[model samples]
Target: MFLTNTLIVLATVAGMEAFAWLAHKYVMHGWGWGWHASHHAPRSGWFEANDLYALVFAALAIVLIALGTSGRWPLQWIGAGMTLYGALYFVAHDGLVHQRWPWRWVPRSGYLKRLYQAHRLHHAVHGREGCVSFGFLWAPSPTRLRAQLQAAQAQRRAQPRQAPPQRPPQADTRGR
Candidate 1:
């Protein structure tokens, strides 16, 4: 039973990648852009409003741990998984890719390189919209993502353009 619980925790950690992907796409880029924008845009300082999302997730994990200790639910494992995943994300994203810290190592391996490039593609977008590679821990090959972005741009460009609204002719007031 203990092993089963551990398995569940591990599974939850893996699943958090997908959960993060969706949340980054919909919530962070959509409704939560007010905070998340600070991340995509140029840096003004060492921190960003986007860091609030981390705090929110940490608070949730604390709540879950408290409940689990109180015997209210089996949420401790889930919370632990989320915390571990968050740490991994911070290392990969903040430390390696974005270089928010002093860590300067670059990825030479295949998967790590893909992860790094995919994130570069994500930041290639000018704003929250029309962005790709939402998942921090996982992403498609950079070539594939680039093709998708190009395809989307082509589709938008191929669409018919709307004509400008015509203004009514003004009266000949100068003659009067």
Candidate 2:
């Protein structure tokens, strides 16, 4: 029973992870670009709009859990899988990959380096090269990822920064 449960959970997680990647590549970066823009903008904040994607996933988990608990085995497994995916994403993307929190050491592997490079490229200049690397936790090649990063950096350097708009001063109502 334990092994069966584990398999179900693993399969669910893998499927959800794939869906998450697709959503990011298409929805978030494509039609939803306006909502995702704050993530690419330079700002002084601890969190970015990219974080909202996690919330959406969490809400999905809640709905899945509801369906699963209501006598639906498939839905339950799907929920379990989504939760696992979210956990893995938090570890791999936020913890290990981005190092949002400090860790004493990180493992040096070609695979991990590749994932890092690919994600860095995604953040590079926001949407120049599409579909080179899309996985959240794993990457197949570091060399290709590095090339993508270099290209993104070059593209960013070639672009000029835009100035912010100034607002007109208003009358002081406090004096009245």
Candidate 3:
């Protein structure tokens, strides 16, 4: 039963990870641009719509747990796997990749670098369109990723800045 549970959890986690990648590429970066846009905006805000995706996933977990309690071992295992994956994603994406908190050691693996590069590509643009690198963990090559990141940064810098809109003259409230 333990082995079966382990296998089920592993498979479910893998599926969930893949689904996350696809959703990031399509939904989050595509149709869901309204929420995710805050992430790319120059100035930071107190709340971002991108967080709703996490909330939705958490709600899904709660539902899965409720359903799994009724003699559904497979479902329970899958739920466990998803919860684990979320935790891992938080640690990897928010913690390691983004450096939201202060941790000094950088990931040394080539694969991890690739994943970072992919994420960098995702952040390279402000709108819904760009190269998609949605996986929370796993990058295949660091050098290539670094190159891509540099290129994207250069491209962004090369774009011309727009001037502020002109305002119409207003009547004075007080006359001399």
67-160: candidate 1 lDDT, tens digit per residue: 8778865688888888888899999899889989965888988888899999999998888878889998887989999998898789879999
Q: RMSD, model 3, all Cα superposed?
A: 5.7
| Winning model by TM-score | 1
Ranking of predictions according to TM-score: 1, 3, 2
Candidate 3 per-residue lDDT over residues 26-111, each given as its tens digit: 88788887887766665355456777888898788867877888876567778888888888888877776676665654666566
In angstroms, the error of model 2 at 40 is 3.0
Please report, in order, the local distance difference test score of every candidate based on alpha carbons: 0.88, 0.73, 0.73
Least accurate stretch of 10 residues (summed lDDT) in model 2? 124-133
Error of 3 at 76 (Å): 1.3
- Deviation of model 1 at 59, angstroms: 0.6
TM-score for candidate 3, residues paired by index: 0.73
Report the error of model 1 at residue 120, Å.
0.9
Overall local distance difference test of candidate 1: 0.88
TM agreement with the true structure for every prediction:
0.88, 0.71, 0.73
lDDT of model 2 at position 22: 85
